[model samples]
Target: MASVGFRGDLSQAFRARIPILYVESYEEHRALAEIAAVARDPELVRTPRALLTWSPTSGLIQPDGTARRGAIDPEDALVAALRTEEPSVFVFCDLHGTLGPAVVRLLRDVAVAFRAGPVPRTLIILAPALHIPHDLEKEVSILDFPLPAETEIRALLDRMIDDNVATGRITVTLTPGDRERFAKAALGLTLHEAENAFARAMVDDAVLAPADLAVVHEEKRQAVRKSGLLEFVEPHTGLADVGGLENLKRWLLRRDGTWLDEAAAWGLPAPRGVLITGVPGCGKSLTAKAVAAGWGLPLLRLDMGRVFSGLVGSSEQNMRTAIRAAEATSPCVLWVDEIEKGLAASGSGSGSGDNTGTGARVFGTFLTWLQEKTRPVFVMATANDIARLPAELLRKGRFDEIFFVDLPTGPERTAIWTVHLNRRLSRPAVAGRLDLTPALLTELTKLTDGFSGAEIEQAVVSALYDAFAQRRPLEREDLVRAVTNTVPLSVTQAERITAIRSWAADRAVAATAPEDWDMGTGNGRAVEF
Candidate 1:
């Protein structure tokens, strides 16, 4: 149901006399306009058909305000369509809401009659959500009517700007680049929504500037939140906030602007995404947040737990809904935290556990989207246990790359320690008399050698607690004592850590740079790019 060449597809269906076509879209006006265009185009449809639209309130009506008398109800509207002899495209709007047994039977009858009748006709059901009856499943073909494309959004913006500026209602101070960014930010919005967003931005101060991009993004946030399937993540951290994983950071930095049109001109595809998996308490989830913040793109978190429903087939629909939302919010990041837990059952046969193949179906829907998605939705999925993940997920092309985030290496530990210490010690109250010198950092780094980033952070917190209890300045001994008392995951889960490392040794790229790989700890690999 992608919108690429959708008009052409609709035309083909019309010419082929595909009796019934269902379009799911929130922008009823836009969908109808497209349908009208195709129906009236003789070159496209080969035989131009008259366009008649129907809603429960308006019933069947032509473009000239000519409504069929006594056809105010859906049943009557269908009856009118069946009686009309002209080749026409009858669009029933929001008919899904009032579907009854009688209405379903009437629709089925219409489908059969339209295909075999003398004149070619098609019934188009347009609704905000799909609600085709089980009996009409084979008869109805659902067409995806996508949100406004970048070009359409840009045009809407330009018209709004021109009108406002011509009337001296607003001051426009956007450069070509800024205009492009505005359009890209509004990509997922409908033309009407984009117009409203642009109007709000222009009217806010009677002056439109680059700062108005926030207003546009805020509108998108509201739209995404309404979907219920995806959470619009407000980024609080960037890649710089992350302690280490120099290789991963570098890879991310290199692809920062690859989602832009300039990169496409250079024949570079937007990065599909990266799978970060390794020791628990490492920076896998943190990296997902940071990537979105660093890229300055909206981050949508897909909670696979919420994707499954108690209903029979709702889970697959939920997955599709989530994907559509993510795609609509593109050039954005789709973060799936703790992905292994959600899709673990999918590793085995078609159906697993008690869900009766629901999990597998949902997983299949997600995997298929991940592989075939054309939008610039960078999927950042994290996992603590890669062993639970399906092998199909680990294969090439599912993700741009699979990064193994091992326990902090010596240099990585040093970086982690530095990040935590600086963040806390920057406060005059916390620093007291402690000096964050190179020697101090080196000492702490060596003490927390096998520790994950989270453990190191907790050590700092624990040291702070100790210092707070004593009501004295933070001393180096406080940190040393904390490290001495704490046991890292590398010690308790040594076997599991070893298994993860062994799996990554050949299959995954070490998140740490080769130079930073610690042979002593057996944490990272010396893999070359």
Candidate 2:
């Protein structure tokens, strides 16, 4: 669940006299400070309570650094909390690992005593990981503690800049816009982590400039890599690298800044996501990568295969973990490549041999999150087999639009040839005096009439290899021979291509522009406006 403000949620729970509150977070100090703030404010919690903290080593300690005598043990700590006369907020730090039977029983006793007492008292358990025993599951309420928001991170950055500038330790060259960009880049990091990133950026060159944003992004990359479920993708190619699909490109470009406040003022909610389904070897995956680069957003690749595990009940947990990680890294793109393979079973009526129904349950969890998620996590999913996709996924509102990528048309093919040729032959060493003339490009495009984008790229690579073997400059003959020797996917899988085209005719908007679509071949419709 999305976190309401931490202080507000904690205060309400305390006011309601919640006996046990479990907060799972890596920010122990921040969590404690928030709790202390709420506990001390009568206006917030409706009752001013003394704050007390306990740890295995520290035992029971008050806010003034005084420890209760003989309360070093877990049981003793709980007993002392129960025996306390004044209304108090008792916080247990890193107690997840020590939840033995004795500790569990004592916790339950404390919960019971705190709830029944006339005075308002609350017990909070703070840990990096949650490990509530089955017996105490009903009694414990999990409260979400999210990473620092953009405003908080921005404040931290401003404070650090002021301090460094006052001491002449570092130069400040960032504009207001650059500061905002830095804060947004550090959105997924905790306050401590953000501080570290800011510090590193400042010290790297004794000055904080716009280029320091890369250092902050590198820090974020490390954090995301630690989460096993999501792979942080470094986009090396932007929309410019993509050869065609002008319609899809235009649609994506229009929604680029919709997540910003300016768009919200215009009554434009952030675009939910888009589904790209097309024949294999087309540019569906490439588009997903290019969009992230073009938008200057971090790209996270979610491997659905990794979400399903052999252990019972772990699949659901994995899905939740993946979703949480994605949400935590907000204002980013989530690329789910080949989504059909992961959700195929969920679409089948008989569960598609998944007797445990784990696939369906996971799918349900994902669908619910996709529909109701408030975070700006743009889901970019691609599918090679539309038939395998669940009908529920294709329904309106799951995605902003569905796009179909077909084999390159004559114009698109020419553009594709030009892109590949220029990318390789532009280098003097690789060019070897070979001129990339317009006539040669047109000839290559005609020779690759039915080739997919991948096929066209391979043909370029093959021609270069042939020239390399001959120890001579790349010649027209080399290119011609490579194109003539290649057999494209549309030739071998003609029936499959026809089936997918027919499916996309009425359902999906063509990726290519209406003018660029090959209407004479009756392949793709001109529905994209």
Candidate 3:
């Protein structure tokens, strides 16, 4: 780790002729302040006066007066300041966009003139976004200022809470645990944003609770929305909300505590993540959403299809930006749906001249980030087809575990039926159905063999439609008729489904039970296509 008060490092680097610095910092003002401090130190510079040229304003300023604002004739001012023959520093702010013919000439002239002289004056360029032209590559040095750490964010949150409470307008008092959790959640947020989030939470409720985190989570959503790279999805499913994944659920539950107190203290590294491969609508996506809610983490969806652009370098740039954003908001959940389609190099094999190499590169980047990232961004990737996935993805260490989401089992079907029916029964007409009971649900499960959670949902819709058409109450016959007409995925893809189960049985963790999975002897495996 870099020691505190490391301003000397930058000054030393400056002395080494490494010129332009590309810093990605949330603390832009802090960087500016540090530069000013270093400039004033006699030991750091040969002379007191310095030339600082910046944009939309005037050129260089002598060190005597407070830093001038809105400098004009930026290039000439820098030249004028450099002509003093004293060791000076020239600071250019946001000059990257304006670096054209005249600006280039001025910079080149300054560099040449300073080298000719013994004063050792250095030119420094500052920009929020980096745009490096090959002409000046060797002339520039880069520095990165990462987002504020959790400690800084915690301090900011506490101060904001204290200020609000001091005014007597906010009566909420935060518990120690609440304070820590809130700070952890705001890890990637800027000092200003951390404060704003806390203030917003206080304003929303006088008593602060973990539930108040929803307000903090909204800031994350807004940040992602502005980026145009990723989407923040509010997960409505919970552990119970997902049906027939008891084994997977147990695996998840064991680690649920890992995110909380014991894991860290026990020196248990955070669980990496999981990949679910199964038939579509078998609750692969649902499990992803439910995991986030179950673990009390924000859920972010990564859409690789949206990452590509017509412009040559845009796709890679988009992916880099999105991945950075995810890292910034760490200890969150990243859900990639139908990941096979996105990561498969063959996705763009139509030969339209789109570099299939981009897919491989992107997937490699993602894999590296997943394994090496120290932050707690748990990734959940779902796929319908294992064959389409690159072998590199299935290799160990990419994810903590890979589970196969086969069809829901008998008991799982009962749970699924109960959950959806209870939800539908919340409606007035639906609740009054004559045959809505657990016994009916058990029978329905048998009829729904090979039906996905999504398919089962459609069956309910079809049953409701049948009853609505007759202007009568829904009954078992209505459900039975709905089931009969709905040629389940089992019948259409029997061979394919069997192959998947057979392949995954030895290799992958079964999301549901494997018992009674055989086709004959009145035994049926619940699966989705």
Tens-digit lDDT track of model 1 for 194-218? 8889989998999999888878888
Model 1 lDDT, full chain set: 0.86
Scored against the true structure, residue 127 in model 2 reaches a CA lDDT of 94
**Position 140, candidate 2: lDDT:** 92
**Residues 406-461, candidate 3, lDDT per residue (tens digit)?**
76667666666776777776777765656567688778988887787788888888
Candidate closer to the true structure by lDDT (higher is better), 2 or 3: 2
Global lDDT scores for all candidate models: 0.86, 0.86, 0.72
Worst 10 residues of 2 by lDDT: 520-529
The number of residue pairs in model 3 that clash at the backbone is: 11
Between candidates 1 and 2, name the one with more favorable TM-score: 2
Candidate 2 lDDT at 194 equals 91
Order the candidates by TM-score, highest first — what do you get?
Answer: 2, 1, 3
TM-score of each: 0.87, 0.92, 0.87
